[model samples]
Target: MNSQTELAALLCSRLCHDMLSPVGALSNGLELLADEDDPEMRKRCIELLEQSAAISTNKLKFFRLAFGAAGGFGDNVPVEEAQEVINALAAGNSRIELNWAVEEQSLPKPAVKVLLNLAQIGIDALVRGGTLDIGAEKRDGNVEIVTRARGGKIAFDETIGKALQGEIAPVEITSRTAAAHMIALLADEMGGGLQYALSDDALVLGAVLPQPEGMIG
Candidate 1:
């Protein structure tokens, strides 16, 4: 397949994989609600359904901004909108804490995309739940992005690391590394680069994108 087609397919697979559990929970909750007439059980089922629905919504919103076409035709997107989706995504896992500090009121579309994707990766790395620190700022005509995950355990995939470094070939990209590859491509396009660090309990991903002269101010 061509590069665009291949990337799209892998991304779709990733989205489906991430969404399955919550969507399945919603279906299961509905089924349980229909089969039982007990008051307390019914209440429990409703609560579960509500939780699943919120998770699904959060994932959809995050995907829309991170991977899909958001911000309309504008050159920049509001920082608040990006924060809302990332916050929602982190909220789904009570065990995970999020710290956001993006100083810019708005960021270029490419910068926002990289920021969201890196944050997503950081959150995913904390399999056993931990803290995700995300910060971005405009410095020296560049947008500096950083996302760090700290937890008891970190699940940093080698393939994702390779993808982020532009070491993975287009034909080799998979659902798991599609976002990483996209980040690398975006960084390259913006005359920037990607870097990362991984240890036993932490993973840090970063990108430096050169902002157009008037984009950040």
Candidate 2:
């Protein structure tokens, strides 16, 4: 299959796989709630339904921005909105903490996209649960995005690392690394670049994109 078609399929596969778990839980919880006769079991089913719904919703929001068309007419998205999505994703794991360091109240669409995906990479890298710190800044007509994950026994998939650097063969790309491939493509298309360093206890990914002329900080 052609790379484009393969990439599209992989992205779809990834989204469907992510949505299936919570969506399935929501369905199962509803089924249990319907049959349960005891008060405590019914209450527990309700709680499970609530949690499943939240998870599904959060994944939707996160994917909307990262993979789908999400922003309005403007080419910029509010930093707070972006941060909220990240926080929601992080909240799902109590062992992981998020530190958002972007000072800008608003950011260009590309910047936000880069920020979100890079942050996700950091989150995934922390296998043992860790702190994910995301930062973005604009200066001298450019944007700098960075995500760092630190924890005990951290490990990152090397395939993802190569994909993020645009070093992976198209034939080797899969659903798991499609986002990284896209990120690398965007960076190269913008005349910017992606950099990363992975270690046993830490992982860092960053990108630099040149802002449009007259773009505000």
Candidate 3:
């Protein structure tokens, strides 16, 4: 198989892994509700159902914009909408706090996708729960995306770093590195570059994409 074919397969695996948790919980909650008899237990089951549903929905929304075809060509997507999806993804983990600093009301869909993917990686690096601060802006006629994950016990995957830096060979990529790989691929296609700094307590990811006219201000 070709390199792109392998990347697509690995990405599918990652999306399936990510979706399985909440979706499976939702299914289990529904099953439990059906078999539940006592009123109190039934109420508890309902609450679980609600929580699972919210999680599934949030993941769906995030994935739709981040991976699927939310809107590839047209008016730029509102930054608020992009931020909301990132917030939703972060909300799943109470340990990670979100600080959004993008001032633009909207950004090109490609830029937004890159932002979302970077945010996802940062959020995942907070192994012990930490601050995930994200910021984006127009600079030197390019969209500069920045994300920082700082915590007590942060863990940065080496493969992810290599993937984002365009150092990983596609054939060696796995489900875990798919998101980073995709971000690197997109940035390259846009005549941009990706960089990162990882340490014991902090992990930072940045990307610079050639900005379209009037897209960022």
Candidate 4:
């Protein structure tokens, strides 16, 4: 197979590997909760169950928009949906602030995936308390998505940036870097480009994607 196809398959496998643990834990917790008899234990189990369910659902939704096909139900996906996806990824712990310039524009699936993946990377970079700003603007028939994470200390392993730039070796691209590389490839496929910059207290990622021809309003 060609290099692009191989990279895509590798990325898909990496995503599945990362998601399997949490999803498996969720299933196991549910099974255990169904058999528990003690009220207090059952209550705790229920809490765990709820938390796990939320994680699974939110992660799946975010990944669907980021790494998989999005805008599944309709011709256009609302901006609100993208906002919801980000909030879900944050999961109440990470305080993410979103600023969207194109409220009425419907992004193509590839653009949405690249944006979501970049957001995920930004979230990961801001482990400590921080603010993540996401913006999307359309100019000259091209869509630009920008994500910036500013906080106490933005810490991201170097490998992720390497993967985003398509410079990392395939075997060295772990689950952490898989999403970034996938997003970068998606941007390239859409006739766009990805860029990343890191400052002392902030990390910024940007993607510029060309809009598809003959797209209706």
Q: What would the C-alpha RMSD of candidate 3 be, to one decimal place?
A: 1.8
Query: Which order, best to worst by lDDT?
Result: 1, 2, 3, 4
Residue-by-residue lDDT tens digits, candidate 1, 131-164: 9999999998999999999999999888899899
Q: Which candidate order results from sorting by TM-score in descending order?
A: 2, 1, 3, 4
Model 2 lDDT vs. the true structure? 0.86
The whole-model C-alpha lDDT of candidate 4 against the native structure comes to 0.76
Q: Using TM-score as the measure, which candidate wins? A: 2
Cα misplacement distance, residue 160 of candidate 1 (Å)? 0.2
What TM-score, to 2 decimals, does candidate 1 have? 0.94
Alpha-carbon local distance difference test for all models = 0.90, 0.86, 0.85, 0.76
Q: Least accurate stretch of 10 residues (summed lDDT) in model 4?
A: 94-103
What range of 10 consecutive residues in model 2 has the weakest lDDT sum? 1-10
Q: List the residue pairs that clash in candidate 2.
A: none
For residues 1-217, write the lDDT of model 3, one tens digit per residue: 2577787788789878988987898899889989989999999988988888888888888888987779534758889888889898888788889998899777778889999998988888898899999999877789889999999987777888998899997566888888788888888988998999988899999999997766545
Ranking 1 against 2 by TM-score, winner: 2
In Å, residue 163's CA in model 3 sits off its true spot by 0.4
Instruction: Give the per-residue Cα lDDT of candidate 3 at 209.
Output: 94
TM-score of each: 0.94, 0.95, 0.93, 0.84
